[model samples]
Target: MLVLWEIYPWRNVEVKKSVLVVLVVALTLIFPLNVFASVQIQRPVYVEGKRIAFDISPIVEKGTTLVQIRPLYEALGLTLSFDPKTREVKGGNDKYEVVLTLGSDLAKVNGKEHKLELAPRTIKGHTMVPLRFVAESVGNSVYVNTDTKRIFIGVFMTYLKDKYFDMSWGLSKEEVSKINKNDHNELLYENNKFLFYDTEFSLASKKNMVPANKIYSFEGNKLSGAIVKFNSSDDFDEQYSTYTQVIYDLNNLYRTSSIYPYDKYWIEGDSIERAYREVYKDDRMKMYEMAVRSGDLVFICPFDFADTELALFLQNKGTFSKPEYEVSIMYEQNKEFFNQISN
Candidate 1:
C-alpha cells in the first residue's frame, strides 16, 4: 500500500498532464489559430468617386489590402502587361511605371525598389497585389476606410497655367470666381453653367490679334471640363498646319492613338462636302475635342465624364461651332458614362 501511494503521485501527475493536453486540443478545435490571422474577405474599392466592379473582390492580409492587378490598373487609365516567362507584372502611365513579381515582397516604381508588407500571390488565377504599395508608388493617393471597408485610389488632376490664366479640373466655383475677378487683362464670361475667360494673349502674328480663350464648364459647384481656344485667321491651309503641329506636340506629351479617315461634312453653297479628317486619341484626357472654324481653333478637354451632360448641353447652345471638327477622347473606365451621353 505504501508503494502504491508513492506511485499514485506519479499517476496523478500523468492524469493532470493528459487533462492539460485534452483541454488544449479541445480549445484548438473550438478556435483555430488561423482565426487570429489577419485575413479579410472581399471589400469594395473606389477610384475617383467611381466604384470598380472587380471580378475578384479585394482581400486584406497582414494589415495590407491586396487587389486584383488588372482591374485596378485599367480603372486608373494605366496600362498593365504581364510576362509569363518572368512572372512579372508591369503597370504604368506616361509618367510612372510599377513592376511586381508573383510571390515577391519587393516592388519597383520607376526602377526604384520598394519593400512590400505582403508579397503578391496568385489566387484563383488572379494576381493579387498590395494596393497601397503599388498605388502610392506611382504617385497616386491611397485611402482606406476601416469602418466602411472601402478603399479609395485618387489620381491628381492635371493643371495647365500660363501668364494670363491658370486652369485645372475639380476647381471650386469660388476659386473660379476669384480668378475671374482678379484678372483685368482678360474678358470673363460666367453663367450658372459655364465660365468663359478670353485671354488677350495671342499666338498669332501682330496683324491677326487672335486671342486665346478658356472655357470652364461646371457641374453643381465643381469644375468638370475646360477648353482653350486659339482663333486663327481665315486661312484653311494655315489652320491645317497649326492643327498638325498642335496634334504632334500633344501626341509627344501624351500616349496617343491615331484614328484616321475621320469624316466631316460641310455645307458648300448648295451641297454638303464630305471631308475625311484624322484625329489623335488621348484617352487619359478623359474627353477632349478639337474644333476648327473659319477663325477659331478650340481644344476642349474634360477631366471626368461627370461633365458629359454639361458638354452636350454646351454643344447644343452653340457655344462652339458644329461638331464637325470635334473628336471626343474617352477611356474605357468612362465607357458607361460616355455611352449614356453619346446616345
Candidate 2:
C-alpha cells in the first residue's frame, strides 16, 4: 500500500499535471473549440459568411440574380409554403411575410405590394425568384462581386476605402498592430507601408482566393491607402493570365479602367509572347511597364518605380523602393496619397 501510494499518479505533482494534460487533449480532440475567423468554405453563394449550396445552380436572367425559393427557405429563416391552386408562394417569419406569384414581377410583403427585379419562374421544376429583392425584404442585404461571380447575402461588403478584411481605413499603426485577421494568415512586411498578406482564399488552392501581398500605406500615422500586389515568378504566359484575372477582380470593385503606358515596348491587349518579344526586343534595356487605373483607386501591372520620375519622388520621400519581379499587378488606392505624386 505504501509503495502504491508513493507511485500513485495523482499523488505526484508532475504525474498529475501530465495526466491532466493528456485528458484535456483527449477531450479537446473529441470536442473541438470554435474560434472566430473568416469563412473558409468555398461556395457560389454565402449567407452571413456561411456557405449555402443550391441544388439547381443560381443564374442571372435579364441582369437579375435568380435563386431557388425552397433551399433559401431554411437558410434565410422563413416558413414557406407553395399554393398550387393560386400559383403563389407564401413565406414569412416574425418580422416579414412575402407572397410571390409565378410569372409576375410583383410581390406582397407584409401586406404591401412591392415590385421585383424579375418575376418568379419555374426552372427545372423549382420555383425561382429575384434573390436581391427577397433577401432585402427579409432584412438581409445582398452584395455581388462581378469578377468573382460570388453572391454575398446578409454580409456587409465594405467599400474599398472603408475596410479590408477586419482592418478599417484611418486606423493608426498602433491599432492595426492587433489586426482581427478574420482567418487570414499574416505575412512579413517589407516596407513599413506593406503589411504582408492574407493566406486563406489565398494561394492557388484558391479553394478560394489567389494569394497576394497587401500594402497598407499610412499618412500621419493613419491608414491612407490599401494596395494589393500580385506577382508570379513562374512562366511568363502564366503570369500574363494571372494578371488578366487580377485586373478583372479589381474591375469588379472599381467598374471602369484607363491605361497608362510608360515603357517603350508597351502594347495594349497584346499576348504574353508579344509582350515578351517587346520586352526583350533589345537586351540593351528590357523593361515592361504600364498602369490600368479606375479613378485614383486601381491596378498597376508591372509597376517598377525604379529609374522613373516616381522612383525619384519615392526615394526623396524614402517611402517606397522597387521590387524585383518577372510579372506583377498592383491594385492601389487613396486619392490623397496619389494626388501628391501621380500628377
Candidate 3:
C-alpha cells in the first residue's frame, strides 16, 4: 500500500456538554463495559475486496459499528501510537494526524479539535472506534450493505481509462466485442506467448484538421500499450512539449518520478538529438517506457524490455513521422498486476 502523506483539512466544532453526557449514558446502558465477552461475532470488514481480520471483532453500539483501531489503521499504512496516561490514541503520517481520547466525543485531527459522533472506547483491552468515521476520515469511501451485513471500503474499478477511451480490462476478448460491436476495426491476434487486441482509436492533434488514427494494444486481456503516429506537418517542439506535460501529470497522479537526465541515455547520433528512450520506475521495480523515433512515440511498460527494444528498432526505420505521445494512466491496475506477478 502506498502511504498517502497528503493532509486532509478537517473542521473543529464544540459539542454541548449536556448532549455529550446524555449520549454517553445511553451508549453505556446499551453496550455495557463487561458485555464484551457475550457480544456475538459481527459482519466482517473488507478493504478493496480483501477481508480484514481484527484481533477483537467489530461490534455495534447505538446503531453505529465500531472496529479495532490498530489493525485497520496499520493496514492502511498509517502509524498509530497510544498513551495510557492520557488515554489518547494518535495515528497518521506527516501529512495528517488523528488524535482520539478514550470516552471523549471530542477528537483532534492535526491539532484541531473536532466532535466525533461516538466517543472511542476500550473493549476487551482493544481500542474500538466508529467504523465509518475513521475509514472515511483517511480518504476511503465506506459502504454498508444491511441486506448482506457487510462493509466495503475503497473504489472498485469497472473500466480502464486510456487516452482516447475507457476500455474494459480483465474481460475476455469475446466480452469486449459484445460491448464494442460498432468498432469494426477491432482485430485480435494471438499465439502461444500472448493474446493481442489491435483497435484503431482517433484523437485530435494540433496539425491534423481531423483526428489522427492511433492503434491501441491490449495484451492478456489488459490495455498494455499504444502506438500513436504523428503527421509530418506537426511541429516537433509542440509534440515534445505535449508529451512532457502528459508525463508530468502522470508523475503527479502516481507520486512517481519522471525519467530524469540521470536515468536517460542517447544512442550514437547528433549531439543535438534528444534521447529516444525514457523509463519511469518506482522503488518497487514497476516500469513504464517511452520511445520517440521516426514520427512515432511507442509506449510499453510492465511488458518485457524485449518488446520495448523491438519498438526502438521500428523507430530507427523512420517509417513513421512526428508521433502523437500520450502516457497510459494505469497506475492502479499496474500496481495490482505487478504485486500479483512478483508474489
Identify the candidate with maximal TM-score. 2
The C-alpha TM-scores of every prediction are: 0.39, 0.40, 0.39
Candidate 2 — which residues are off by over 4 angstroms? 1-43, 157-165, 168-343
| Residue 75 C-alpha lDDT in model 1 | 78
Deviation of model 3 at 323, angstroms = 48
lDDT of 1 by residue, 36-92 (tens): 233445566767656788777666656787788888887788898989898899999
Clashing pairs in 3: 295-320, 295-321, 295-322, 295-323
Model 3 poorest 10 in a row by lDDT: 304-313
- Report the C-alpha lDDT of model 3 over 138-162, residue by residue, as the tens digit: 6666655433355766543344343
- lDDT (CA) for every model shown? 0.50, 0.48, 0.46
What lDDT score goes with residue 265 in model 1?
21
Deviation (Å) of 334 in candidate 3? 24
